[model samples]
Target: MASSRRRPPVEAPIAALRDALARIDANGPVLVAFSGGLDSTVLLHAAADVLGAGEAGSEVESRRSLLAIHVDHGLQAPSADWARHCVGQSDTLGVDCRVVRLEGAPQRGESVESWAREARYAAFAGIAEEVGAAALLTAHHADDQIETFLLRLVRGAGLDGLVSIEPDTMRGGLRVLRPFLGLPRSALERWARSRGLAWIEDPSNRDERLLRNAVRRQLVPVLDRVLPALRQRLPQTLAALREERDRLRELDRRRLETVTEPSRSAPGRAAALSLCAWRRLPAASRAGVLRQWLALHGARMPSRARLAEMLRQLDAPAADGLEIRHDGFVLRRYRGQAMLLPAAERSCEGAASGFCLPLRWVGERRVEVPELAGVLTIERIGQVERVEPVGPVKPVGSPGRPGLAERWLQAPDLELRARSGGERLRMHPGGPHRSLKKLYQERGVPSWARRALPVLWAHGRPVWAAGIGCDADCIVSKGVRYALDWQPLRRSRPASAPERSQH
Candidate 1:
């Protein structure tokens, strides 16, 4: 008979950690997602041992390098106190602790549970990325796993929903780690009690009004009477389903690499791929591939049903062309070609045909494809995009030039505006990657003229001159029946301290 495989040791916090570290292709500097709770307190303590105090501790002391992030979900009455408690714990632990505050009421009618958790997690993620840490450690233990599985079932979630909260997941390059995933909350609580540790007790936890609370206090125990091993079985069940899902997704990806072809040279090739190539996949894979394709280009993913229904229309006729749009996936068939557009570019549509979005916020907009500039409106013959690059900018300011047009353009849309500090560009011909100030001297564009000229950033680099000149190389001739054109503008910058860099 085959021998049974053993579960992970699941104890000794660093033991789980070392194995996780080995699995990654690169060794990530680890950071603990420390909350002042019992679970995370122990997690932080465990992590302190893995990385040395001086080398990994994120403190003002000589023992520095480790980072701890605590998010203040301002939902409870003692939210501030909770944050202070977290900070105090970090100081005691000899790690750098930063408390992030999230404002606004929780999603109404949802008991503030969903919103608070979402906000806290977001703030935690931000701090993790801010530090040079590549991995984030959380203290989600066995009880939480059972709760999660139950919650998913209660909410009518699919098989994927019952899966264990991912112990290691990559979020914007930061891999999330949960050392306590395999351990029970009771174990950690007992350990902390033995160590004589004190923890914050939010009163809401005991209130049975919340479903999670009710589950914690009632349902689980009641079920324990009938099914003793149900809790143990849930996590394993979730793991199996998750493994199956992962394999299927990989198979779909591999199948696509063989069947798909890129034809950028053909007119409307992108559109052609959307209409025909997207339909060739197996019904199960078609929707997934279409969603994947759009997401690759910065578009959002659509619902499975929405994508399937869209392809279902394909049997109608070649002339019937299909346009399916949902969840930011824009599907349009033109000249027997289908195209997917990024939802972030809705404003560009007005410019593409000549229209303007009523401003919700005051800022310049640049369209990189067919190069467009501020208040982009359709123009006769060709569009006009502006470019204005400033000199010496702050990190968050204009990057020395206007936020140029987006980089993913198909031969059009270009514009620029002024921003502050450390802006670098090869503004003048034959110039090294020099500052914008140097470009003005070589071109004699004049100091006063520099602030007035808007920058034309194209493909993350400036490649156009607004008003007086255009990038001599990028212009498409008007003679072509269908040609991409750029209209650029140059303008001065406003003042503001960049509080936080874009995440």
Candidate 2:
């Protein structure tokens, strides 16, 4: 009778909005890719509200500064009408509106949906660049994340893919933030409806033919009928799964640090990972480790078949130049090392190990290209043709680039030579196989050099790898684009004529 109890404070969408604003670690003049869809329109409204609350300015000025962009995908039947509706809405809301038209022939053999989504993001990225925005925020609600995670699980993806979407990521050096990952789609609908906000309905969304729509309309409702509490439990279940994924990611991180190279050659990138270390781990651990390694270097994780092949390669001794390919790339090993250079770095030198050629434009001084070391030109060549070397060709064992012989070959064959004793072979298998390039150097070869000189036929095509330990036989032309030629510089030495040099 004497005690009075206080009621709990009410939770609101405004509170949710404020929390999202607070989580943004950096201050922003952020540019939202506002599509005027329910999610984006809500986000635009929320952002404007937050900006005005924080900054010292009039409401009109603050709201006017909020960038509301509407994209006309030109796919749906009434897209222009929808664009006009969005413009009118933005005007009513006192936000600046801009319409962007995305034009491209929908790629054949791909879903228009997929193409459209990619186009939308590309357009957003372009605008973000123009506006100099640090981050682009999207309203990918909890339901979207759940659907994505379920899709990945059904697709038999590893945890990296199963992790679905994250709260944030740095994309193309631009930050992309998804704040509503914890809020349900129903919550967004309810919030909008409460404010008398109407959303444009895309007819494609209702198409039962789409897998996601079938999942939403049939599979999910059936599941909900069977277990009414499934929706409530999903968020927690996702959290638990993510926690498990985090632990796995940490384990993968440790393995990557131990096995991956700090610096690697085009070939060494693959070989840097030790087969012994790979085999020692459990199967699950192997997959986890490989996933982490691929992600680190901006490569997509290999599929189960490809991962199995890599394991097979690990089982094979380092000596065999094993190759495993997936996702349009060929991963090959040489001299107990693996290289991922595109199939084009393979090419013969312009001349022999120590050929002397005069740069005609620069006058009579001879430009010396070392036989085994990298290209060393005392005089520059301005008029030589360009050969974009592909495949396993690399400037191995140089001071700046060890175990990375085939990395970013700059100024290719511009009066190159087999310069003596100063070279090193950034060998495959082993990170830096010692002195392979140095051997050519010690022998007093030319100004620039390669560790192993392949069999270059009369036409100057490299028909073989270095023939010492590795071969350029596997490194050849590409399938899609035109194969690159060995850039300019005429060979002065005969095919079999060996320059007098001894290591």
Candidate 3:
């Protein structure tokens, strides 16, 4: 018997969404960042369907809590109506809805699209916190990923930036999940239509004045027509890039550890690396290492031109004492070491005029010298309390740090002051006293770093310098000595402060 048989329509979108939810298996309430757009509409519907439909037809026993949130950017005239539509949809689905209205417009020089996106995410995070949502779902699909990839590619992004979208990530303390990253917009439209779901059509999406809109309106259609298989193959390419990114991250960590050391002066929280070791790495791998190194020190990624210029200067063997300033931090190379220090907060004129103040030390363990942009740590070690030396004052070696005798500081005439020119330091026991300027040069200290290296003066003479060791005459061969070390304090660059352009 030849019976008329019809194939069931393919419902790939809902099946994919169900599979994603099953894999995620969130423990608590899931909140959807619903925009009333087609993609989000479909996602919200599927979430409510999968979660609202309990296992074994026991809705009361197996159903999970679901919520929907709408952010009204208030950019367009009909934004309020869209928000109402979103609320109505949520009500029909039996899901709780929250509407957040953004109050202000975009800042001057900021793109409207960028402003809207930032505001929307901020709203999502706030509402998620308010509602105690365990996860926040967004409807960023394969098309969005492709656009992001192309945009970043044209903007000179590296391997790390090429892989644009992820299945999930933590943003502003919210677990932001994108269940539709693998699904195309066509599939979402089909699903929405099949379920007779109504959605809002955002007119701004077709406006090509914005970069993303232009790409979607013009560039994407061309790509779709020219390369029909791109969407299918692009994910594979992105996957490869992601794998490389992960591999390079691990390699960079190991390499950074090998070539870097903590700043000798700032023991707890500063970074210093051997410039010689960094130079020895393969030319191709150097940029990745530099990016990772800078990132660890709280720096934003440098532009390609800036990063290239940095590499050029760093690779030059004769480039002594170079400083590359970026994003509230200064990267300085001195004495074969690269140090990342916080950018000085003082203005150039202010620093030049006011940095020479004489600071009195009253035997405090820690002395914060704002003028010098660092803190002085005076640590008293050893148990002996005697004023006299236990043994003859020995020659100060290259490695040892000479300590100041505690007895000498009993009355403590210690004063911290900037170099006044013509100051001399006898670093070794029998070594000739050299000018502080000559000493700094001989030690390969950069000029910019020298201005902040405070000298410890006692009784109108130079007794200790921050980077330079203790003067030979003041060295204590014995008893209860104070070890003097200075660490550069980390100060943030003021929002109004201008970053020195990297040429």
Candidate 4:
């Protein structure tokens, strides 16, 4: 009879992980995302062995702190027990453990899988921040990469999507390190069994309804039987794809540099480019530039169909001022230039119409208007005793009167509102009144943004419009001039104000 003995420990997986970690060279502390699964268990064990727990006579040189973080998604019945199991296992290994309990369920129309992943990563980011760890490790192995590539291929993803699962990348200000990407799942299982490590088996993993499980159970087995060399070939294919992607990205970067213009109103946001300049590129290069620009602004790349539609719209005669909405942002073309703005800023879209907020601008220097999403500043200019009319001295309300400063101070409390319709402004004192619509059209303001642009009204009369400047009726004498500054708030809390544009 054959001997009933256990197989010897496999050191290849552990060795590979050590080499990957060394190459990563994390300068600060490390946090492992311990899910109490076989792959993660092996990862946690290898990490603890390589990064000692500051004990004496350890083989590891660095004494950096090591911690395990388990996120309880609370989707499974045994999830709580799994968390406890992870904590216990980490304790047994002399590593600190943290269990983050997620609150709330996935919203309507949200995929449970995507929600779980987003929540899990959010928890990891928070823990990494709390612990001041520089690196966050996960146990995504070769199998996961293969499954992802296969899934993306089936979904008809582009080159970047095919190579999405990177070995190391930055996420939420922490270095997200996947050290086991080169190691296979079988290697991890062997290592775990050799060390007598305990782990939980998620029953949901066996459900073929999930695409990953379906691939793992049905497709991978068939692929293994039919083409045994596929596993080796897939990685090589991905490496070549990555090289090609890098070349295309470098070319796109150079092209973007030539056509990009700094946003005059929003700093650190997506830059603007002339439609003429964008159209000058080859069709393929145009798509690449668009992808790179969206990536720079942290926006998701649009689908190929949507991208083609955008390109088609760019060619239309009316497309010069059209707004194309997609993926939480609005792509607008204004004055032959294309730029992106947040979708929420589309105050005129659907049921959420533009709002009007009252502002009592007496002697205050600054006023914050949430509805318009920006601040207004009134800086008092130095007083002048008497002033002579300069060349082409624009008239205020009266021909012999002062400029904007004196008139603005005499105005009553202002009503801040976005454009509704039928608004008009005087281009000059005693000039013919023109519709705000016509004025905006002539000035090349995108139609979508006109609704969100701030318009200050005193009592019932329009006094100032952002980007258009103070009303000619409200212009004060040359003496004591005050500049009315309108600063638009950024998507994030900006470090500095964006550059202002004066009409």
lDDT of each: 0.52, 0.52, 0.72, 0.72
How high is the lDDT of residue 307 in model 3?
90
296 in model 1: Cα distance from truth in Å?
Answer: 3.3
Model 4, position 83, has a per-residue lDDT of 92
Q: In model 1, which regions exceed 4 Å deviation? A: 1-14, 17-28, 54-64, 103-118, 258-273, 294-338, 351-503
* Residue 54 lDDT, candidate 3, scale 0-100: 22
Please provide, for model 2 over 1-503, each residue's C-alpha lDDT reduced to its tens digit, 9 standing for 90 to 100: 86697855523444565565555555435666666678876776666666662224523322224566777998777989988988887777666677898887676665787667656666666676677665667888876776787778898986556667776665544566777777877777787787677667777778888888878777776776898786677767766767787777787888766665522233222435655555667766777776666554445456588788776776676544455554334465543334443322222233343543322322323322333222222222222132244333444232222110121122133222232333334334324444545434443332222422422221122221222222223222332111111212322211112111110
Residue-wise lDDT of candidate 3 within 141-248, one digit each (tens)? 999998999999999777767878777665545677777888888888888887788999988788888898999889999999999999999989977877777788
lDDT of 1 by residue, 400-476 (tens): 22222223122233334442334455433343555556544554333322343344445555543332223333333
Report the alpha-carbon TM-score of model 4 versus the true structure. 0.74
Residue range 120-227, candidate 4, lDDT tens digits: 877877777777787788999988988999999999998878875777666635677788888789988987887788899999999999889999999998988999
Runs of candidate 3 with Cα error greater than 4 angstroms are 1-11, 22-31, 53-135, 152-157, 169-175, 209-211, 222-226, 265-267, 318-325, 342-503
TM-score of each: 0.61, 0.61, 0.62, 0.74
Question: How does model 2 score by TM-score?
Answer: 0.61
Those runs of model 4 whose alpha carbons end farther than 4 Å from true positions after fitting are 1-10, 23-27, 54-58, 94-96, 101-110, 126-132, 172-174, 262-269, 348-369, 375-443, 455-465, 468-503
Q: How close is candidate 1 to the true structure, as a TM-score?
A: 0.61
TM-score quality measure for candidate 3? 0.62
